[model samples]
Target: MVNCVVKNWQGEQSGETTLEMPVAKEENAEHIVHRALVRQLHNQRQGTASTKTRAEVRGGGRKPWRQKGTGRARAGSIRSPLWRGGGVIFGPKPKDYNLKMNRKERRLALRTAFISRVEDLIVVENFLDQLTAPKTKEVVNALTRWGIEPEQKVLLIVTDTTPDNLYLSVRNLPNVKLLRHDCLNIYDILYADKIVATSEAITKIQEVYCGE
Candidate 1:
């Protein structure tokens, strides 16, 4: 079991919570993590690149000139690939870039991501709920008190519904990402230098990925 320090809203150490060793193993398969990351990145692509073909371009209905005696190569339409301002040949088309991974692959992937960053994980109790007003300085002070530097990318995982104040407070902070509990994934875990997880967030993560 790994002992994670549980810090309160005031930035003081409240207590310690235990994480199952099976779920917090430090040694993770790099290939699994890499594959999961690649899949995630691939799915994120918008894949909207597109180019018009000869038939799609307008003002191409009529031939440029007489086909039989033209000094240049014979052309059928003004939009022919051979003509100026012509449509592109073999150009890219809009496509779906999403890649799917099975349940087993995804489960292992999330587990790997969490385990790989065991040492950097900070489990904070849910004093964030008490924050009714958005205060950027409050978030900064909390992290500072916890000894977590904010300059590096930090991933904050909260319970199902992140409170309005917490969301607004961290929303515009530089290098800080606020995400809900169930949405945890390999990309954010690996991308972050440190992870600040709420108490409920840990339970949710363990419930979903610890089943493996």
Candidate 2:
């Protein structure tokens, strides 16, 4: 267990919290990479949006020409991919982009990512109290106290439910993102310069990644 000290909105010392560092687990690097890639693919697909294809465009119902009669090649609907303003050829469709990775692989990737973050010294003090609401300045001050820059993008992982105050406080900060224990993602972890998580979240991460 590692001891970390975090401050609250009041600028007072909020005491210490004990967290098990799961990033130190001696897991397979290959497994971790596979899991992280799967997660990246999953996130991309989950938030995907559907866009209309040219073939599905309106005003393409009419045939442009008669077959074998005109000098032009055999023609179909006006929306044919060959024509200008026609439907796109082999364009992206609205489908699931999710990649199915094995459970063990996913766990490994998460572990690997956690290890990488720890190696970078990005993981910091764990918070204990749930602030009444999110306060951007408060979070900023906490980071400043820890010698982290205010402009750094920080990922805060909370155990269980997300506190209302913390959520609201970091919402407006472009560099900061708030995630629940179950919602940790490889991209987010990789993108963040610092990670602030609760003890419960740390434990959950360990169980999921290290099986500890």
Candidate 3:
């Protein structure tokens, strides 16, 4: 069991809450974490890098000149990759970068991430109601009052729907990302320097993934 300090809307320490760590299968933890990390990486990739190929580029419908009679090098079409303003050669194309992970692996990864939070002592009190809107200043002030650095990347995990104000306020902050309890990903957990979550989210994770 971990004892964490809860904070109120006024940024004052309210009280303490006790939570039990979920018991997870050690054998599956690593695999789950790996898959979740991979999934997150894949999701982040836009994979929108696209270039026009010879066939897709405009023009080149007719040969530029006679194949062997031209005073210059033999030319097949104007859209050749060697020509300027021509189609790209082996250029990147837009496509899906989504990667599929087994359900068990995903669950395991989430559990492992939670376990790490527990080990790191990063999980803190749920402060969902602390801010009414997406005000970066308010969020920064709250973190400052709690001794959390505003410059560091902070991941806030909410157990349920994050209020519009909370979402709006944190969206513009460079070092902050709003995540739901059920949406906890390994990449976010490991990438962030700190984790701030609501008590409800903590309990949900322990119940669903750790079976505490």
The TM-scores, one per candidate, come to 0.87, 0.66, 0.74
Give Cα distance to truth, residue 202, candidate 3, Å.
Answer: 1.5
Residue pairs clashing, model 3: 32-109, 126-198, 133-165, 134-168, 134-169, 135-169
Lowest-lDDT window of 10 residues in candidate 3? 118-127
Among all candidates shown, the one with the greatest TM-score? 1
C-alpha positional error of residue 57 in candidate 2 after TM-score superposition, expressed in Å: 7.3
Residue lDDT tens for model 1, 32-146: 7777899999998999999999888888887668878657778779888877888999999999989888877777877867877989998999866667789988888888887
Q: Over the stretch 115-139, how does candidate 3's per-residue lDDT look in tens digits?
A: 6675433445656666655677887
Model 2 segments more than 4 A misplaced = 1-31, 46-81, 85-88, 119-134, 160-163, 207-209
Q: Looking at candidate 3, what is the lDDT of residue 35?
A: 70
Tens-place lDDT digits, model 2, residues 64-86: 77888678878778777777777
* Model 1 ranges with Cα > 4 A deviation: 21-28, 67-74, 160-162
lDDT of each: 0.82, 0.65, 0.73
Q: Enumerate residue pairs that collide in model 2.
A: 32-108, 32-109, 133-165, 134-165, 134-169, 135-169
